[model samples]
Target: MSARKVGMMTEDELIHVIRAAVREEFSAAGMRVDAPADVDEARRDFMFLRRLRGWVDGTASKIGGAIILAVVSGIVWLIVVGAQAFFNKP
Candidate 1:
């Protein structure tokens, strides 16, 4: 294996070398990689995911609330029925 000298490269030169090496490796392996160039596109993606999560959470909370309300209403109805049956008998 060949040896490389340490700290011999400037920052820009080092960056260029690293980018070239990555490009060559990817090209040799026949892979395609793309990076987003626009900040707006990334922001829109983040917002969409946030809205989707909020929608899911809101729907779940509504369903849970409705279930609890139904159970409480059913229990109240049964209690009313029992009270009427006991009090109206005499």
Candidate 2:
């Protein structure tokens, strides 16, 4: 089919052209076009997984920070006690 300029196309023709272009792109990318219901289900699954990953990453970062802080505090306490003992030696 000959291509018509967008300005020359009716609404229906524009819509049809747009849909055909989209389908061609999808096929070229090796992607399957799903039905509406399947698309909705896939979207839900993707969102859930994304949220779960974010939560796990945040929790891990917080736990790691807490552990590092505790280790540093312990080292500081030991240094303070050692310094006091060294200065008080008779």
Candidate 3:
């Protein structure tokens, strides 16, 4: 195609020119430019469910870690108290 001033091109013509240039650049770089696949309702729903499950799993792990930390801290406190009482005995 002959080079033309961008200012002379209409909106559609500009888009077409840009797309052609991009495709050429991608092909030169050995990259494939495939159109995106259409996502149907079922696929969208499944994606949302997957995201929700991931969030729930992350939150559950955080809660489990906090519970474990609290249990460990309680055990440490008991050990410290017992040691102090034994050391202060008559």
Candidate 4:
């Protein structure tokens, strides 16, 4: 069945149709449909959190690299200046 056709039905009508389907399925198998299966909402939430964590980790790593580069460049500049000062003739 198309989604549009299902959507056109009222909420009660939809529920009634679903119940009927379930009943028919259960009757065909000679089984009871009293208890439904449990859904894992936490799994979806955990995946969303994990993705955010990855993004934050990548951003932090990039920022840390930039900081290390800036510090190393400054140290190199200081060493070059000190060497030039101490080695040049008076």
Give the best candidate by lDDT. 2
Query: Per-residue lDDT of 1-90 in model 2, one digit per residue for the tens?
Result: 679644677989989889889867876876445577755765787799999999999999999999999999999999999999999999
Model 1 TM-score (2 dp): 0.57
TM-score of 3: 0.55
| Model 2 stretches with alpha carbons more than 4 Å out | 1-33
* lDDT tens per residue, model 3, 1-90: 569654676989989979989877866866546444322543676799999999999999999999999999999999999999999999
Q: All candidates' TM-scores? A: 0.57, 0.60, 0.55, 0.49
The regions of model 1 sitting more than 4 angstroms off are 1-39
lDDT of 1 by residue, 1-90 (tens): 359767778999999888878866765766433345434555676799999999999999999999999999999999999999999996
The candidate that achieves the highest TM-score relative to the unseen native structure: 2
lDDT of 3 at 84: 98
In order of lDDT, best first, we have 2, 3, 1, 4
CA shift of 16, model 2, Å = 16
Which 10-residue window in model 3 sums to the lowest lDDT? 34-43
Which is superior by TM-score, 3 or 4? Answer: 3
Q: Residue 20 error for model 3, in Å?
A: 40
C-alpha RMSD values across all candidates: 6.8, 4.5, 7.0, 9.4
